[model samples]
Target: MAIGDSVKPAAFQYHAPQSVEEAVQLLGMFASDDGRIIAGGQSLIPTMALRMARPSHLIDINGVGELEKLSVSDSVLSIGACIRHAAFHRPVVGNPLGGLLSFVVKHIAHYPIRMRGTFCGSLAHADPSSEWALTAVTLGATMIAESLRGRRELHADEFFVSIMATNLAEDELLVETRFSLLTPGTRFGFYEFSRRAGDYAVAMALVTFELVGGLIADVRVGVGGAEDRPRRLPEAEKVLTGHPPSARLFEDAAAAAAAAVDPMEDQQADAAYRRDLVAVVTRRALERAAA
Candidate 1:
């Protein structure tokens, strides 16, 4: 069925620009009103179908040149806004942050959706259960957004405001995301729970740590699907940061993370259940990270 068939709305303007500059100008021109930028059309299309978003103008950015490049530099990996989830799973990418991100992307929604769901699209969509957002936050990534006015950068912690909310301006477009290169001693792990394999996560955990001389030197932990936005577990990280990776440390970190989150009771799971799941998955991920 057609999108308009599902959600009846008046036809609006559609423009597919060939360059980022052109798109920026178009956005500037329509900045006064309800204008939406469409990249992969994965999230926006569905929202439009459901009548949740009805923009007066649709600015398509797919044709913009060089927005799909995935480049790895000496200290960072820069992923363009248009890079799809499938691109992330390519072996040639040589992602050193463990297979956690690739595993999550490979299972997101299904093959058909993964084929079209762009990396930035998922970030921009800012769904609480989105693996891309969780992974980025866990890795201490940066998001780049641009507009006719200028450009701005946001750390993963500052980028996501709430569920389905972001720090992006209405006229700005997310152009790239940069992830720090994993150090040689860094260890990584990810875990998520859901009713089905391809379904959105009910609770997810990501952990990155470094082992120096058999001791934990640094640690970062992030959890998703348990709150309105993905969040780092600073208390949990502290519990593991300077200590040896032991069963006791993992347990303490998990308990700290569970106490830190404020999950809401939804149809998927109760608040208490999510809090418990956070502890469980945090422990599991920490175990894997320390292995």
Candidate 2:
């Protein structure tokens, strides 16, 4: 037990599954009690210690090294369930995903937390304010999940249903998430506001754009921490795509983004304040991408 953490988790059986097949079988067997999968344990352990989560069996998949797969195939990136955030922070030359990953990983938490945290763990956790989750939504990433029954793929929009919620089945393990590489001319910008460094963002904006003949050929805007789920701001994107970039247009798009999501009041910030932050970040992100 760590010092100052006196609260103990409820006693539970543990299973270290060595293969995806074995993991799914155990997951299916424990569906009655709702088995919990632990990947870095950054979120799971805390929830368990708080007595907020008590699973009959804890399935630790770290032993299944196949889940640690990380490779670039055909210029697209496929990140496995067990790949640590620290691996994504490494310097890689001429890789767009690596560049974006490094930027996002730096904002996740402290170095030790990054060292231990898995990218897929955060994706499965489905935290609305997670930088990775926000980026996944912006990238329109694909999720691969496997169960004893079979395997299925999910798009980012289809996977995240709400805050702390996902389409992942109880008996399925998230195997990998695939991300498309941005084209050569793509311009991107990511920004967020938190009370302090390493703290969860109160409001965040991620933008990507491609210019053709001095007009926006493609554009995407994703807002996080202000609503129940990460989402692309279609209204905002509509304002930019096929139009020439302008400060006035960006201002309008920012307003559209603030209107796109219904943020709720919380101790961290009120609905009105979050909406204002959303506008500010969205405008800045769009401007940055245009620049």
Candidate 3:
């Protein structure tokens, strides 16, 4: 039977490919057309159990050695899709991005779950509440995708579309991600509000700013869980671009961010509340970055 015909989270064939080429071939053969990539399985497994996602095949890349690399070359950091969130929870020793990643991963979930969650999987899943997505938008990360045809790279802005969605094509496999190194003197801050410590965030904000002399040389503000996808607040950033940091200025900028967003009401939060939370967290994140 064709894979797409199987619904109800029914039994699925599993394939463990030892290399990217093999994985790409398997994806082209069955998984990509109607199969799912099983990397961390932190999100996909639960969805499958609930029958929300009923892919007919599971393509496992756990044994793909090259897909597990973490390295920095020529100022670009490339992280394999299969790396566990736990490995990123602490400073990566030599990589500065490690510090920022560490800050975000801590709020992903508790210890055990983090040990099984993949950074690229979160990127691929494109959860609006995902800290990875927020960071990707804030930092303008790039994603690398491979297929039997060829390879393609997409910027963060191009990759994410909406909640629980991404631009990744069905026959393509996310291999790794590349992040341009932040300039020296850049400061970053993040804040999120969730019902509980590990619950998905209701509203999240993150910022990166660099001060020169007495003025803000550059600043970027982004919010998630307040819209369909992670949103970069260029209007708010504009307010702080060359201005000196102050409480009133930050308030105005944060207000702009809140006003610019269109949030949705769900069981966890109302649209109004999430909007307010976005303002609060945006302000807090800016303040933290400025300090």
- lDDT of each residue in 1-291, candidate 1, tens digit only: 985565565467998988888888888888567887888888788777667888889898888877977887887788898888887575434555535557667657778788888999899989999989999888888999999989999999899999999999888889999987787667887888899978988998988888888888778899999999999989888888778888998999999999999996789999999999999999998888877
TM-score, cand. 1? 0.93
Residues 92-188 of candidate 2 have per-residue lDDT tens digits of 3365566767777888877888898899999999988988999999999999999988999999999899889999988888999998888878888
In candidate 1, which residue ranges exceed 4 Å CA deviation? 1-10, 98-100
lDDT of 2 at 175: 90
Worst 10 residues of 2 by lDDT: 91-100
TM-score per model over all chains: 0.93, 0.95, 0.95
Q: Which consecutive 10 residues in model 1 have the weakest lDDT in total?
A: 90-99
What's the lDDT for candidate 3?
0.87
Give each model's clash number: 0, 0, 1
